[model samples]
Target: MKKQSTTAALPGKKTVTAIYIFVLAYTVVQLFWWGILLHQQSKEIAYYEQLELTHRVHLLREPSEFMREMQRHHHEQRMRTLKYIGEGTIFLIIILAGASIVYRAVWKQMRLQQQQQNFMMAVTHELKSPIAIAKLNLETLRKHKLDEEKEKKLLDATIRETNRLDQLCNNILLASQFEHQNSQPFFEPLDLSQALGNALQELRDRIQSHDILADIEPGIGMEADKFMITLMLNNLVENAVKYAPKGTKIEVSLKTEQNDLLMRVCDEGNGIPQEERSKIFMKFYRIGNENTRKSKGSGLGLYLTRKIVEQHGGTIAVRDNLPKGTCFEIKWQDYSLQPV
Candidate 1:
C-alpha cells in the first residue's frame, strides 16, 4: 500500500512540475510579445505626432521650431522605449531566478523521497532475511536429531543471523538518536588499541569468509566513549565485509603520527565510483537501486559511522584503495592521549 501510494504520488508531482514550467514559459513569451506590441505602438504614435508637427510648421512657416519639436519628441519616445524594455527585462530576470530556485528545491525533495523509499525497501529485506534464516535453522534442529558437528554449525549460523538482526536494530536506533540530538558521547579515558583489537577479533571470529587484518599500534589511548567507538569500528569493518567479495582482504589499521591519530579500513573489492564518494555518508543513501542490488543493507552504517566520528571531534573520508576497492580514512588531529 505504501509503495502504491508513492508510485501514484510521483506522477502527480511530475504533472505539477510540468504545469508550472508550461505556465512560466507562457508568461515569459507573453511578456516579450507585449513589449514588442508596445514598441510598435509607440513608434506609430511618434510617427503621427511628427506628421502633425510638420503640418503645423508648414502653416506657421518656422522650420527651426519644427526641427526642435521633432528632436524632443524622438528623445522622449526613445526614453519611454528604454524604460519599458528595462522594466520587462528586470521582471523576466526575477521570474527566471524564482523558477530556477523552485525547480532545484523540487528536484532535491524528490531525490530525498526516492532515497527514503529505497531505504524502506532495504530495511524490510534486511529485517526479514535474518529472522527467516534463524527460524529455519531452529526448525531444522527441532525436527531432526542432528550430529554434534552439524548441530554446532547450525547453531553458529543461527547465532550469526541473530547478531546481524541485533546490529541492524542498533543501527536504526542510534541513527534516530543522533539525528534528534538525543544521544551524546560520554568521553572518558579509553584504551584505543585494545578496543580496536577486540573489535577486530570479534569480526574475525564471526566472519569466516573474509581475511581480517589488523595493523594496530599498541598502547594508544584516547578520551572517547567506548561503546560508540566499538560501534563505529563494527560498522566500518562490516561495511567492508558487505561490499567486498568473499575471501577478500579487509585491512584495519590504527596509528598515531605526531599529535594526530589515524584509523583506516581498506578493502580489496570493487571500488566505489568517484561521483558517489561524497554521498555515501548521507542517511538512507545507498550506491545502487534497492530493487536490483544484491547487497544487503539498510544504508545506515556509514551514516552512523560518520555521526559517531564527528561526535568524537574527528573527521572521516573515503579514498580509492591503491589498485582496487575503497579505503575509509579517519583522523583526529592534535589529539592528546589519556593515561591508561
Candidate 2:
C-alpha cells in the first residue's frame, strides 16, 4: 500500500512548543480571574460580621440575621460555581495540549518509518546495477583465458562486491519490513561466529584493499534470525570499511560480553566527529567530517542495520576508538523460541 507523506503527518516542533505556550497562558488567565474574584474558598467571617453589624444598626430580629446569612451562603456558592467552571476549562486545555503533543510525536514517527521504507526501495534500486555489472564481469571472465591465480583473484573480487551489494539490498528489505512491524523472524539456535565469518568473507576484497584487519573469536553464538545476523554484520563491516582511511586496519571481534553476544567492528579512520555522533543512526544522518563524507553511502545502511538488530532484541552503538577512529558494537541476547 502507498504510504502517507511524513511532512503532512507530523507537527513540527515549533508547533508543539506554541501549543504549550498557549496552554500556559490560558492557565495564567484562569488563575488571575480566581485571584480577582473569589480568592478564598473558606467560609467568610466578614459575611457574619456584616450581618451582625446591620442587626445592631436596626435592632433587627434574629430571623433577619439568619436570612442575611442564608443570602451570603448563596453568594459564595455562585462564586464557587464560576471558579469551578474556570478550573474545568483550564483542565480541558491542559488535556488537549498533552493529547496533541502525543499525537504529533507518534504520527511523526510513523511517517518517518514510511519515508525510510521509500528510501529502502531506492537503495534496492541503487544496488541492482552494481550487482549486475559484477555478475556480467564474472561470467565474461569464464569465457576468456587467463592465468588461474589472477583469474581467481578477479573472480573473488566480483563475488565479494556482488555479495556486498546483495547484503545491502537484503538489509534494506529486512529493515523496511521490520520497521513496518511485518518481519516474522525464524529463530533458531545458531552460531554467531559462522554468520559473521560469512559476511566477512564477502567483504574480504574490500577489507584487503582498504587494509582492514580483523580479529575473530570462535564459539560466540546467539539465537536470532540468521538472515538478520548477516545483514547486521554486513552493515557494521561495510560502514567500518567505508569510513576508515586507506591502509588502516579494521577489526571485527566477537565474543560474549557479559550476558550478551558482543560483536565489535573498529576502524582506524579519522573517526566520527563528536557533534554529529548522536544523529549517526538517523535515516539520513551523514558525518560533517569531510573525510568520511568523501566515501559514498546511501546514509541508510547504519539505520537499517540498527533496525535489524533491534528486531532481534539487540543494541548497537558507536564510540570513538581510543585516540582515533570509530568502533561499533552490537550486543544480542541469547534466547530461544520453544517449539510449538
Candidate 3:
C-alpha cells in the first residue's frame, strides 16, 4: 500500500485571488498608461493639423516651414511618451512586487489564525474532560457508600485525572515560556539515563497499550534542566504510544557517537508522512483537525520538546523507522554537555 504524504495544500482561494489581483493591476496600469498617451497624441495631432489649416487659409506663413516645425514637435512628444511608458512599467512592477509580499504575509497570518483556533478547541477539550472526570469521580465517592477497595479505586481515578490536568497545564506554561525569547532555562548536570528511566516509567503508567523497550547507556551525564529534559522525554514517548498501534513496541535508546550524544525514541506505527515531518513541531499544528481527531493531545508536546532540546544546544529530528514506523532522534554535541 502506498502512503500519502500530509503536506498541507495551499490556500486555493487566496492564491488565485493574489494572482488575479496581480494580473488585474498590471493590466489596468498598462491600459491607463497607453490610453492617456494615445489621447494626448490625438489631441496634439488635431491641434497641429488645425493650426496648419488656419495658417494656409490666412496665408500667414510658409506651409513647408510650418509642416517641418509640426513634425519636430510630434517627434519630441513621441520620444517623451516612450520614456514615460518605460518609467511607468518599472513603477508598476515595483507596486506589483510589494503587493506580492503583502499577499504572502496575509496568507501566512491566515494559516496561523486557523491553527490558533484549532489549538483553542483542542485545549478546551483537553482541560474540560479531565476536570469533568475528576469531578465525577469525587461526586461518585460522596454520593454512594462503597467498599474500601472501590472507594480507593475511585479516589485513585480522581487523582489520576487531576494529575493529567496538571501535566497539561504545565505543558501549556512551558510552551509559553519557550515562546518568550528572553526566558532563561536553569541547567545543571544530571544523569541522562536516570532521567530517561523516570520519563519512560511515567509514560508507561499513562499509556498502557504500548510496550516500551529501553536501551540506555549508563554514565552518560549532561548539563540540562532535569525537569524539562524529563518532560521532553516523556512527551516523545507519550507521542509514540499515542500514534503507534496497540501492543506494538516503542523503543528508547541513548548512545554516544564520537563527540555527540544521540537519543532516539522509535515506534511501530503508521508513520508520519515525509512532508509532515517538519511541521509536527510547530505550535498549534496537529496533523488533523481537533474535532475529528481520535488521538488525545493539545498539539504543544512536540513544539515544547523541540524548544527544550534546542535550549540545551541540541537538535531533534524525525525519520522513518526501519520496517514500519517513525523514529525521533535527538543529538547533542560534547560542546553542549557539561560535567557536574
Candidate 4:
C-alpha cells in the first residue's frame, strides 16, 4: 500500500517561508523609504522659503508652493516605489520557486533514505532466522564424521559461510539502527583495554589461520558503553583483517589525547581512495575500484561506528596512515584511560 501522510512542514518549508517574508518586508521598506524622503524634502523647503527665498509676509504662499513641489516629487517617487515593489515581488516569487524545488528534492531524498532503511531492516530479520538455523545444522553435522579430514574441511567451510551470513545480518541491523532518530543505545561503562582484549580473544581462530599480528599497545582504560565500543572495535579489527595484505600487522592503539580517549586502528591495507573517504561513512557504501572485499562484512561497520560515537558525543574517522595504509581514529570526549 502506498502510504499517504499529511506531513507537517519540515525545516525546508520554514526556510522558504522566511525567505518570502524577508522579500515582502523589503518591498514595504521601499515604500517606507520614499515616505521618509518626501517628509525630509518638505522640511527642507519650509526652512528655505520663510528665510531665504520668499514670504516676508510670514509664509502663506511659500508654504503652499513648497507643499505643491513636495506633492510632485512624491508622485514621481511613488512611481519608482511601485516599480521597485513590482520587482521585489517578482524576485520573491523566483526565490520561492527555487526554494520549493530544493525543498521537494530534499524531501524526496529523505523519503528514499527512510525506505532503504526499512528494506534493510526487514531483509535482515528475514535472513537471520534461516542463517542461525543453517549454522546450527552445520555444527550438528560435524558430530558424525564420515572421514576425519573430509568432515573437518566441510565443517570449516560451513563455519566460514555462516560467518559471512552473520556479517551481512549485522550490517543490516546497523543500518536500521542508524536510520532511527530515537535509537536508545544500550550503554554500560567498561574498561577500554579489557574490551579490546576480549574482542581479540574471540577472533583467535581467524588470527591463527591468517597469521594476523595484533600490534596492541598495553594497558589503556577509558569510560565507554561496553557493547557499543566492542562493536566499534570488532568492525575495525574485522575491516583490518579483511583488507590488510596477508602476513601484515594490524596496529591497535588506545591512549588519552588532549583529554579525550582515542583508539587508533591502523591497518597496512589498501588505503581508501581520497575521493571515496568522505562517502565510506555512508551506509551500503563500498570502496569501488579496489574490488577486494573478499571477506564477509555488511559494509556498515564504519557507519555504525560513527553513529555510536555520536551517541556518546565522540567522533570516528579514517585517514591515510604514513607509508601506505588506512587508520581509523576514534575520539571520545568524556572518556579517560585507566591506570597502568
Best by TM-score: 1
Q: What local lDDT score does residue 61 receive in model 4, on the 0 to 100 scale? A: 63
Query: Could you tally the backbone clashes for each prediction?
Result: 0, 1, 0, 2
- After TM-score superposition, the amount by which residue 136's alpha carbon in candidate 4 deviates from its true location, in angstroms, is 13
Query: Which residues of candidate 3, in runs, are more than 4 Å off?
Result: 1-78, 335-340
* CA deviation > 4 Å runs, candidate 2: 1-67, 70-78, 81-85, 88-103, 106-164, 188-191, 207-209, 219-225, 256-261, 270-295, 307-314, 332-340
- The lDDT, on a scale of 0 to 1, for candidate 4 is 0.66
Candidate 3, lDDT over the whole model? 0.81
Q: If the candidates were sorted by their lDDT against the true structure, best first, what order would they fall in?
A: 1, 3, 2, 4
Give the number of the best model, judged by lDDT: 1
lDDT tens digits by residue: candidate 1, 281-314: 9999998877568888889999999999998889
State the TM-score for model 2: 0.61
Model 4 steric clash pairs: 221-337, 221-338
**CA-lDDT, candidates in order:** 0.90, 0.69, 0.81, 0.66
The residue-by-residue lDDT of candidate 2 on 1-340, one tens digit each, is 2233435434554585678668666966765676545535333544565565566655656777767866776786677766666776786677667767877886677656655555554565457767786878777787888888978887777876776676666765665676688888889877777777776776674567565555666755566788777777777777887777777778888765555667788988888777777878887556542222356566677887788778778888888898788988887766332222
For 1-340, candidate 4 gives per-residue lDDT tens digits of: 1122213324655786688678667766765676567656755655664354334434546677776766665676566656656766776677667767876796667655654544454455446755776677576676665677766766676675576566556666666767876566765555567678777776665454334445455676545577677777777877788778877777777776667777788988778888888987776555531123344344577788788778778788888888989999977776555664
Which residue pairs show backbone clashes in model 1? none
Rank the models by TM-score, top first. Answer: 1, 3, 2, 4
